[model samples]
Target chain A: MGKVKIKKKSTFIDMTAMSDVTVLLLTFFMLTSTFLQKEPTIVYTPSSVSEEKVPVSNLVTILISSADKGKVPEGKDATEAEGKIFISFSGGMDSTQVAPVIRGKMLDEALKVYNAQAKDSKKIALTDAQKKVFQETNMLGTSFEYLPELLSKSLTEIDKEQGDMYNPNTGIPIDGNKDKNGHLNDFQIWCRAIYTVSKELHDNMATDMGLTVDEAKTLGDLYNAITKDGTGIAIKADKDTPFTTVETVFDNLQTMSLNKFSLMTALTSEEEAAPAKH
Target chain B: MAEVQEHDSGKKKKGAQKKMTIRVDFTPMVDMNMLLITFFMLCTTMIKSQTLQLTLPTNEKVQKEQQNQAKKSEALTLILDTEYTDNNLPKTDEATGKTVHNVYWFAGLPDTTFQTNLLAKESFMGDTKENGVKVQQGIRKILREQNKDVMTNYDELKAQWKNREISKETFDSLAKKNAADSTLTRPVVIIKPGPNTTYEALINALDEMQINQIARYSIQLPTHTDTLLLENYQQRTGETVIRPTVRKSVVY
Candidate 1:
């Protein structure tokens, strides 16, 4: 039997085509990517047939925590963690009033409203450093009483405490403090602050940006966003959350006269009509 | 393709330089690009969330005289509730893997006397096809039946848009105008979500309103009469309806 010799070949594979493909994909991703906003708790918003897209800027996101269906500490109710509200503000990118500036103004405005209604002993006074920290916070959930302490902590500690749903001091208190002119809850105070601050910025746009009210309205600035069109405020909540929990937020908004708002939802196609059963 | 090759002349000359081939290995470039793509994929949100615009009437009490009353013949009410498991998690439909949303609807002012089929029960069955024809099922069927005029016009407008006879903006404005047309016989829907109703169920109800092209609808808390109707329906059907609140809210 004659043995045939196999020719030896190099074990190298060409990566030029692979490199070209990856580069093209990387370019596409770099151009189309929008970084996911860091939220303390995750929520799966309900799906709807509504086609309106959430505005990119000049928006206030009210995030409500869902029940802890995951791990729960012994002897603790999972529902206790539900309904914690966090507020995040996004200002227009090109506007003079960016996120940090608007946030700083919101802190001042919230404190003013809270102090106006709070008793002398209950009043909150934040240090300059704490105020600076508050300005950098993307999503804030603590009540006014805990705001100073929460802002004093390091970033890691702040995140840890905020994620701890059992912590009584974590969420913005949404108890039944409904009188608009009188004592308002921390959630109400935040809403009032947002409204007042946006109005102030909208009025100043005439002189500051050299735009008329009509022009600013066309631009869909923060002022027109919250007041006129109602697309500015978005309520993001877990789909499985109880109606009563969402109703609490709605009731508070209604009491504050922010009757118009949008609910965040995933897109779903309309279901076809059902067939008749024989 | 990745290598730069220098070809040498066959004829040898004195003082001729040697031809060298330069090869470029693209493995590292591919690796770096893959790492970048992974990073971008993980950090980015490709599907932007949509928004359903909602406008609630102000909480301030409206004067009774100023309140507009719907004609009794053109009123429909939907009460929403969600099923839960023993562990207090929302119960899902085994077939579709979707949360089971229970909806109870009644026509006109709640028939406290129970003289008619006061509160009929329905789930969000969506739709089904029979003989290649689409038909509405569940609560959607009832709502669509009530708002037939508006839906007829809406379907025509939709067909026009689909056939490229009208632009999307024109179709949208025309459909909106048709939905709000006062001359059309439209049903005024009152959505009353029970305490146990999930937010998804409420959204489903709102979506039905949009789908049916119903112009006037308002969300209200379930009244005592509504509770009575639910209790009566439960007694007649022998289905356990009003359970204690599964998840107590944090509200004081």
Candidate 2:
């Protein structure tokens, strides 16, 4: 037997098939994957079993951070949190390096489209060349009057506290105040702008399908649709933030007649538990 | 690396060189593909964040007709506020390190004018798990009981669907319809989060509402009667319930 078994064979095996499968898988993931949006301030939303997905379109995100584990300056009142907030959209063109500029441009373009079509509407309209340039913007935390400075001012200094969005000054002024003539403040204005653009898109899409404006309302009335589908308005607040602040935010929304919204929460596996005071 | 091999066929033609075979090893290609797959897997976010739907009723001025709407027998009001420690301020739980949230709940109005009874108070500490059997010892138990009607209906629908007596769509639609019907005997929960209540507490309370499957629920500022009850409860029990400044200017 030893004399007969003298032949040696090469150990090479073709791996072409394995490589083909792996390459296919890689391409599938690359094409289908959606990247997580980079939040200016990281937050741990309260846990719940609600598995409803945040809508990927026509979303207006109101990011709020109050008492964001901030350091109290010596001798400053510790109770008064330097909280802040900002408005973000689902169509966030995340060029983080030039966030404000790109966001501002997007807002600018959206408004131009919105205003051009609002010739007969009763609502107050904005112009492309408004004295305050809100088009070249970052996460806007300013008023309508101060928007020009907010847009043009170099973003380097403004973006410093962006990491700590709890920087009190950076939040859009949403003090739960309504103008004497009954108008949404700067914060609500931004929300309305997003909604207006969404409505325009909805109308455009409907018209393309040979539908009328009245028919468009049933399809996508940005106000109620936002509230109904994909949490129309998501108020992401810090867990420890006082309810008054949340209430104030809600109060502002109510003033705009935007009565429907959703709250963002983390998914937790823990079984439903309640506060133990029976 | 690929190497050429001379295949010496038994039959050869005149002036024809031996046929050569080129075998290319794909091990390096497979390794690169594997690396790419791993990178894509790590970079991709497969799970999207979840959203909990909430609808705030219009903040329009209340009409006389609405004010005249009589209160039902099963109307339950839950006052969410923070529990304070020695400093008369909100306290965090020692175990979870989260703020200790409490509920001042009642089936109806508490004795407010010259009242002496202690207003019922319970903390929402659902952290206890005993032998895999959860001990329901909190205001949740009462809320669950109040919402039993819907649960019973839901169970019936689920059982019917399981037995194939009803289609899944019919079962779902009927179940939600039954739960949301205000004319039914189910309890109506009114949630009022006090100023001191944390956002987590409000969310938890809302979660409780969802868990209970209660349909006739609303988030409102404490009404005048509720305010009176709270004042009496605070004076009598000495529980640190933050008296949220009722914005007299705004109406729920």
**Of the candidates shown, which would achieve the greatest lDDT relative to the real structure?**
1
Enumerate the chain B TM-scores of all models: 0.92, 0.67
- Cα-based lDDT for every prediction: 0.87, 0.64
Give a tens-digit lDDT track for model 1, residues A1-278.
87897989967778999999999999999999989988888888888888999998999999999999789989999998999999999988775768998999999999999998899998989899988887787898999998988999987788888988888997898877667887788999999999999888877876777987577677667777777788999999988999999999998999999988999988887772211111
Tens-digit lDDT track for model 2 on B133-202?
6555577677777778777787788889999999988987998798887766788788888756777788
Output the worst ten-in-a-row residue range by lDDT, candidate 2 chain B.
Answer: B243-252
Candidate 1 wrongly placed segments (more than 4 Å):
A1-8, A209-216, A272-278, B5-20
